[model samples]
Target: MPPTKLAFFRYLLIDEMLRSRSRPFPTKEEILEACNEKFGVNSISTIEKDMAAMRLDFDAPIYYDKRQKGYAYQDPEYKFLSVNLSEDEMLALSFVETLLGEFRNMPIFSLFSVAVDKVLDGLELTKKLHTEKRHLQQAIQIEQAPYLKGSDKLGDLLRYIAEQKVIEVSYQKYGSESTKDYLVHPYLLKEFRNMWYLIGYHEASGEVRTFGIDRITQVLPQEKDFLPQEKVNFDAESFYFYCIGVTALSEKPAEIRLRFEPFLANYVKAQPLHHTQEIIEDDEQKGCLLRLRLIINHELKMLILGYGAGVCVEAPASLAAEIRREFEKGVAQYATKN
Candidate 1:
C-alpha cells in the first residue's frame, strides 16, 4: 500500500532518528515520543506499521538490532527519497553552481557550497557528471575579488543581528587618518559589487547609516540590548528604492533624462542602470532618449562620467552643470599637462 502524507512524514522522522549520529538507533518508545510531539499522539503500533510500509514499499534497509535494542538501517547511507533531474534542469543547476563561484571566499559561500553538494548528491548527479562539473567550472568565467577585507566579521555580525545585540564597531573611512568607534544597532548586511556594507541605526547620529565592512577595523559586542526605537525597521528594497548604488543623497527621486548614442543606447536598454529607467524616445538612425527616476549621487555621477561623449543630459540643469564642470576640469588637466 502507498503511504499517506502523514505516514510519509513519519517515515522521514524515523529515518532521521535511525541515521542520526547523536541519537542513533531509536527505540520504539523514543520513536513514539518524537512522532507524538510533532504529529500529535501516534501509538507504537502506528510507528511499526509505518516502518513496515517503508521497508516493503521503498526497500528500506531498516532492521531491529537485538543487541542495540533499537531500529537501525543496514545500509547506513540510504535515503528515502531519490531525486531525478531532466537535461534542462541539470544545465540550470550547473549554471547556478558556476554563479555561486563569485562568492567563493566568503563565509556564506562555504555554507552554500555544502548545501549545493548535498543537493547534487541527493539528485545522484554528482557521480554521473563529476568530470563535466569540472569542465563547466573552467568554461564559465565570473568576476571575483582578489581579497575581501573584514569578511571574517560576517559570522559575528550575523549572530549579533539575529540576537538583537548592540555592537561597538571601530571603523575607518577612506582618506581618514583616525579610526572612530560607534555604537550601532545592526539591522541588515548588503552586498554590492563584490563589497559588503552594514546598514544600521547609529545611536549618536540618530539616523540609519551605511558602513563599509572592508573599512571596519574591529567589532565588539555590547551587553546593552537594541532599544525598540533604535530599530529603524529597515527594508532593503524600500531603503534603496530611489537610490543608485549605496548612497542616498535625498529622500525624493529626481527625474533624470539622458540621450545616449545609438550603440551605447542599445547596451543601456539591455542592461539598465536603474529599475526606474524608461525609454522616452527611440530612434534607429538618431539615438535613444532614456529617463530614470533616481537620486543624483556620487555613483550616478561616476557612471555618467564613464559614458562621456556618448551621453547627453537633457533635464535637471543642476546635474547637467555638474557633469559639464567635471568634463571641463578633465579637459583643463589634460590641456595643462600637454
Candidate 2:
C-alpha cells in the first residue's frame, strides 16, 4: 500500500482500539462504525487487514477474545503507538549526548543523562539504535572551563547559598595576613574561569563583598538569619553589569573603553563583554574601540590579557598603569638572575 493509505489505515485501527478501552467488550461492527465514518471505509476485510498490519508493525499484543467475541489488547502494558524515533530524532539525541559527555564531572551532567534516557525510552528506540547513532557528528561546540582545583570548600558554600542560610566563614582576604571571620547573608554563587566566589552581605562590615571560594578555609552555618535590610532590591544582572570580573563593587560604574585589534574586534563585537557594552569606534583599518560602564577589576584585566596583543585597556590612568606594571613584572621574570 502507498504511504498515505497505510497512514490512514493505521489511524483508523488505533482509533477503534482506543474507543474499546473504556468499554468491557466492543463488537467489530461498533469499532468499524466509529472508524468508517471518519475514514470513508466500511469493508470488514479491509479493517481486518489493517488491524493485523498494525499488530505486526507496532508489535502490539492485540487479539480476539473468544469468550467475549470481541478484540482486546493481549498485553495490557503495551501502548498503541511505540514512541520510536525517526532518523532525524535519533541523530539529534546522539549529538546532544556527545556534547554532554565532554562535561562528565559537571553537576548537571547526571540530570541531563537521565532526561536523555527518558526521552529515548518514550520513543521506543531499541538499545541498538541508540548505540549505532552514538557516532553521529556534532557541529556546534562549547568550551567549558577547566575543572576547579583546590576548592573542596565551594560545594559547601553553594549548599548554604541554595538553602538561603547565613554562614560564618573564615576568609583570608587578598593581601591580608589575618583571616577575617564574617557573618554573611549569602546572595549568590558565581564561577568565573574556574574560580568560584560567593557574593554576600557581610553583617559586621556592613558591606556587600565577593569572597573567593578558594580563599574560604572554613564555612559554618549560623542559626541567626541574615536577611538584607530591604530584601536585597538588587537585581543580579544589573548589579553585576559593570563588574571588573565577578566582583561588582558597590561603587558607581565608569565609562571604560578598550581597544581591540581588527582580527579580535569582530570576535568581541559578536559577544558582549558586559550587559552595557557598545562600540564607540569601529574602523577596520585602524582597529576597534569598545566602551563599557563597569568596574575595572582584576577579573576584567585577566580577560583582557587572555586576548594577548589583540586587546588593550584604554581606561582610567590607574587601570592603564596597572596593565603596564603587570607586563613589566612578567618581563622581569624572564631576566637573568645573578
Candidate 3:
C-alpha cells in the first residue's frame, strides 16, 4: 500500500483511541464508519492490526465490552496515550518541520509531510505544550539558512545510492568559478551543522570523496551499469571520527595542545573543544593546557581564531604557525586603515 494511505490509517486509529476516551464507547462498526468518512475506506484486518499494535507496542488498555456492544478501556481511567511523543521529541520534530518548510511544495517529501503531521496529531499535546513549541520555533528560523538549490534531488540521489548505481553529478567545489560534471558512484549521504554532504566514489578518481549537496547543481541518472561499492571500502563511521566539518582530509591525526586564558578556563572545562580534549596542566598565571587528538584542518583553525586572544595553540608548532600567519594577515588587512 502507499505510505501516505498507511499514515492516514494510523491517524484514524489514533483518532478512534482518543475518541473512545469520551462517554458512550464506540463500537468497531462506528470506528470503521468514522474512518470511512475521512478516508473513504476501512478494513477489519488493518484496524485489528492497528488495535493490536496499540495494545502490544504502547500498552493501551483497550477491550471489547459486549454489554455496550463497543470497544472501551478495560480500566476506565486508563487514557489512550502516544508514548512516542514526549515534550522534547515533539520539539525536535517541530524544528524539523520548520526546517522542511522551505521544500514543502517539493513532491519528494509530500508523503513524509503527511506522516509528520499525523504523528503530531497522534501526540494530542496540551495547549500549553503546543504554545511552547510555537514560541521556540519563533525564536529562530532554520529555513533561513543559505538556500541549497538542488536539495530536491536528494531523494532521487538516495534512491540511486541504495541501488548501487552511478549518477551524472554537476558539482562545483568551494571557491571554484565553474561547475564540473562527472560520473559519480553514489554511496552515502552525511549531514553536519544542518547541511548535507554526499560521500560518493568518483569514477574519475577511483576513490571515495565527499561532495557538499549544496554545491551539487544537478544529479541525473546514468545509463551505465551499477558499480559495486564493496571495493571502495570507505567506512563512513570512522571516516569522520577525527575530523570537524566536511572539508579536506588529513593523512593522520596529531595530538594538538592548546592553552586557554585563566578567565576562560572554566568555560573550556565545561565545554571542551573536542572529544579527545584533556586537561594536562592548570596554572593561575600560565593558563590551562588542554590536548586534543585530531587533524589540523580549516575548521579547527577557525574555531581557535574565534576565541581570539583567549585561546592559543601551545603544541604542534606547525598548527600554531598557521594560526599566527592568518592572524598576521588579518592584522595587515586593517593596517591599511580602510
Which candidate should be chosen as best, given TM-score against the real structure?
Answer: 1
Q: Tell me each candidate's RMSD, in Å, in order.
A: 4.3, 10.1, 7.5
Count clashing pairs, candidate 3: 0
Evaluate candidate 2 by giving its C-alpha RMSD to the native, one decimal: 10.1
- The alpha-carbon deviation from the true structure for residue 324 of candidate 1, after best TM-score superposition, in angstroms, is 0.5
TM-scores of all predicted structures: 0.84, 0.62, 0.66
TM-score of 2: 0.62
Backbone Cα, N, C clashes tallied per candidate: 0, 3, 0
Model 2 C-alpha lDDT per residue in residues 205-322, reported as the tens digit of each score:
7777778876787889999866852575656556676685686765677777889989989888898777788898999876899988877666778887778778787886777788
| lDDT per model vs. reference | 0.86, 0.72, 0.75
Stretches > 4 Å off in candidate 3: 1-114, 123-132, 135-146, 174-177, 223-230, 248-250
Candidate 1, residue 226: lDDT: 88
Count backbone overlaps in model 2: 3
Which candidate leads the pack in lDDT? 1
